[model samples]
Target: MSQSPTLEEELERARDLSVSDLADAIESIGFECTRCGACCTGHGPEADREPHTATVFPDEVRELQAATADHAGDETGDAGDETDGAGRDEDAPADASTEWRDVARPMPYGLTDGDDGPEGETFEWALQTDACGDCVFYEETETDGETTGACSVHADRPLICETYPFSVALDGTSQPMGEAVDSVTLPARGDADEAGDAAETVRAHECEGLGRDISRADAEELAAALKERAVRELTEAVGVRDTYEPARPGPGEVVVHDSEGAKRPDGTSVDD
Candidate 1:
């Protein structure tokens, strides 16, 4: 006699599930990461597909900048100034000019160029892409002239990255990122008819690792990581929101913030 639960309502109930229960649910199906790196490389020009995205939060942006700055300093003699007189190693990456923020731009989905709004710009950032349009952090390693994909900054990668091809489906139909394209369709749950439009779809991240055998232990591990990512994302989002000063005029309004600091919309630096 009662109505069905919505996706958000289902996720709320999912949040209260125990680790064992969550793992069991996912494992009952199965999953395993084979390190194919399809999600990382995305579709390329050779494949005639557009670049895929991994969303990032504001704090993660700061973290990336800090890491890049630290790396840059080490590459230059700057770290030497802070420590002993040892200059940078000769074998460092040559690009000292690549700053952290430069690695990411506004994702094209919900933004136009310079569309930071009349107020202040939100501080969102994302992983940068390379010349071929793959993630900049993604690298191709050649062993025996065979190529393999890897993340250059794996440890520092965002939560969206860590939990790719997997999410808590609201309809109690927890499954791989998706079942289309590179994914195989999930076995229809018993309540498929009832699910209707309420069922959440997967990202179908085009991973080769789906449908593999996943143990209870493996599912538990995934559950723990997903939980951690959820908490961290919310915390960072709140901190970022609390810190934003909306009254400050952004690019479209008056002055704008740029690499050289605040500037007029006409491109003259405020310092000038």
Candidate 2:
């Protein structure tokens, strides 16, 4: 059997990818989001009851927290109350205790569901889910009996969300992270498959917009984001490999191994 690529090799491969070629492949396959919410819901037409789970970087988590807090402040200001009447600054930074949990939770892949809750060691963070198993930030609207779904934190959404349905074929990394719902395989270079020497391929995943026409500009923009995501993912993988340390937690406690190090579900660092 062939050996798996090392983290360093994967990082080099990610860095060496050609963004222009990726754009060409994307332009060839084409895409336009249909706003169906399949990517954000637990029960969209193309999805099952599994809650949406996407890897979120620590910085992305902080960005979401700040965005949420800013939105809350805006709402508070609109209510015509800038102070608690006790002369407290209503615009103060959000309390990490309350806001952080709402933004992200421990990535549940390596955890086990226990009687008390999930317990075990997991790797990375995932967007928090609502009671229905949908992403907490997912929202739906009805207009004249037509329903459409959207992300409440769309602008600040993580790179995983931005580069959905598009991933590159690289050893030691899975960008979309699952079986392709629908896909168009575009070779990274010229056709040389019969000789078993073809380059990597750009993969398109499940989405209603797969075959839709896309302008070159939009395709390039998406390509750029996809390249950025690929690099970030591999970089993070290297960090995790370098910093990993086994953790032992009692039942109902969870340990998350992220690029930074192990952490509790609350985003607090776990003492070594």
Q: Any idea how many clashes model 1 has? A: 4
TM-score for each of the candidates: 0.59, 0.87
lDDT of 2 by residue, 1-272 (tens): 54666778667667777777788888888899988888887753545467778878888999998788666656666677776553334666544223668989888787898888999998889889997888899999998998898998899999889988888777656555446754445444443354343366788887888889998899888889888888888888889889999999889999999889989888888883
- Please give the clash total of every predicted structure, in order: 4, 0
Model 1: how far is 218 from its true place, Å?
3.6
On a 0 to 100 scale, what is the lDDT of residue 266 in model 2? 83
In angstroms, the error of model 2 at 126 is: 0.9
Q: List the residue pairs that clash in candidate 1.
A: 177-202, 177-203, 177-204, 178-204
Worst 10 residues of 1 by lDDT: 176-185
lDDT of 1 by residue, 45-119 (tens): 676866655666545755776666566556567644443334445555545444544556444443335565543
Show model 2 residue runs off by greater than 4 Å. 44-48, 83-98, 175-178, 181-198
The TM-score of predicted model 2 comes to: 0.87
Residue 259 in model 2: shift from native, Å? Answer: 0.8
